[model samples]
Target: MGKSEAQTLLEKADKKANSSGGWFSSSTTKYEEAGDMYQQAGNAFKIDKLFKEAGDAFAREAECREKCKEVNEAANAWWNASKAYKRGYPDLAVQALSQTITALTRAGRFRQAADREKEIAQIHLQETNDLRKACESFERAADWYAQEDATATANACFKDAADLHADLEEYAIAIERYEQVADHSLTSNLTKYSVKDYWLKAGLCALALDVVTAKRNMGKYASQDVTFPSTREAKFINALVEACETGDVEAFTGAVVEFDQVTKLDNWKTNMLLKIKRGIQTESIL
Candidate 1:
């Protein structure tokens, strides 16, 4: 069959599959067939030096196969998306990601979905400065786990949104959200207390807000109690103190770099770092 006939056939198949509403059990066969047709069209397009068309066909095939839970097929779609992204077709990349997200979401693997969503959000933030939209995407992602009452995951989403907001200098909203996570009442979840990892996140957020507020207040609220921050908190505090003491942007940037290297924090590490970050010369618990 000619490439035009094959493309037409594939398009019809895709419309049928879409009408089925992604109910994979009923449409898997149709998707599998459609995917094969798309592949043939994609190959034809590639042979004709139509990389863009080839990518679109491959991406569509991947999306169809992904809905059918064909992991290899889904991965291939992402590979095609990468090719498209490399070819400077961000729209194709976005399409590929959309399919990937659908697969991840349907599989009930929310963490992966959240990660992908963040990746897309980052791209949007970088490419278009659509921070508000990025924030919305993050919120949707957080809501996914939040619906499951996954406090840790939800807190992380909130934290990311707060950071973006901070970047926009929306400090008050950022601080409030940070506090909501940092001061999350685990009074019900005492099991997390013995587990220093959990509270470390809380402590980090608190320390950051305190420091941010201090800077905003020109040291009016600067307290010495920023002791024992989580390892993550320690980095920021260490950076701030070093920045103040040495007046080195490099050292200061390193200290306040936001990503955390430590997954958990020891109580001692958390406390000590928090104190120092808050301008306390020592951990003299008051």
Candidate 2:
């Protein structure tokens, strides 16, 4: 049987990789060169639209680099495999990214792992539009950042996950994350002033759940942040909560209008509040 083109390329790559005193030799330079050959073969396979073959070649390159203790290079190779897989096989791409994250984390590259996690989140968000997967990826990134003591980045990732959950109407999760952001903010003098805003957002998420839950959450937040002063945002949230508790549609509309006249709700907030109002109206009809 004739050797196929891909098989021939793989054989050549293997030959080059094993040339320097075997695959486990301590010669970083030789392994790097071998990795380059494998990468070239992978790229060729990718151009030929043989995604699985390309992914396999890139995985081999990553393994070679890992054996050489070139952790960063190995991670990059894995990431490249992910990109190649992304073109035709999203599930494979996700698997490749997971491998890259594991490699990076094993190398104690927390920041890089976090970055890769963010990429996974983007893949989930943009490619698959899988909100649950996207949220989980972002949460994983936040966890990695927290491991590295990157508080600001971690908090940002948490906020991103929270917003995605809120968009999916996972209000309970959103509330938890919003409170986390607020708590983290309060821990830093520079961000302390912004805590109230997050708390308000959390309160809004709670309000989306039920009036009783919202009231309980409001009390919890108030107790958590004793320094949280009276603000228009707080007032608006309180009014909304009260209206919801009473199931007073007219009062809810009035409160929203009054708040808008004073501070003007953004489109997202307006939409969210409108949804709550619509729910109240529907309940009244029922």
Best by lDDT: 2
Residue 219 CA displacement from its true place in model 1, Å: 13
lDDT of each: 0.58, 0.85
Candidate 1 lDDT, 1-286, residue by residue in tens: 4556546655765675566545544567778877877777777666666677778778778877876779756765665654555355655655666667776776676766676676667666676577887777777777776776777777778777876665554656765665566455333464324223333333334444455443433232123224324444344444564454543445544553443343443454444344444443322232
List RMSD in Å for every model shown.
10.6, 4.5
Q: TM-scores of all models?
A: 0.47, 0.78
Worst lDDT window (10 residues) for model 2? 20-29
Error of 1 at 99 (Å): 4.6
> RMSD (Cα, Å) of candidate 2?
4.5
lDDT minimum window of 10 residues, candidate 1: 216-225
Backbone clashes for every candidate come to 12, 0
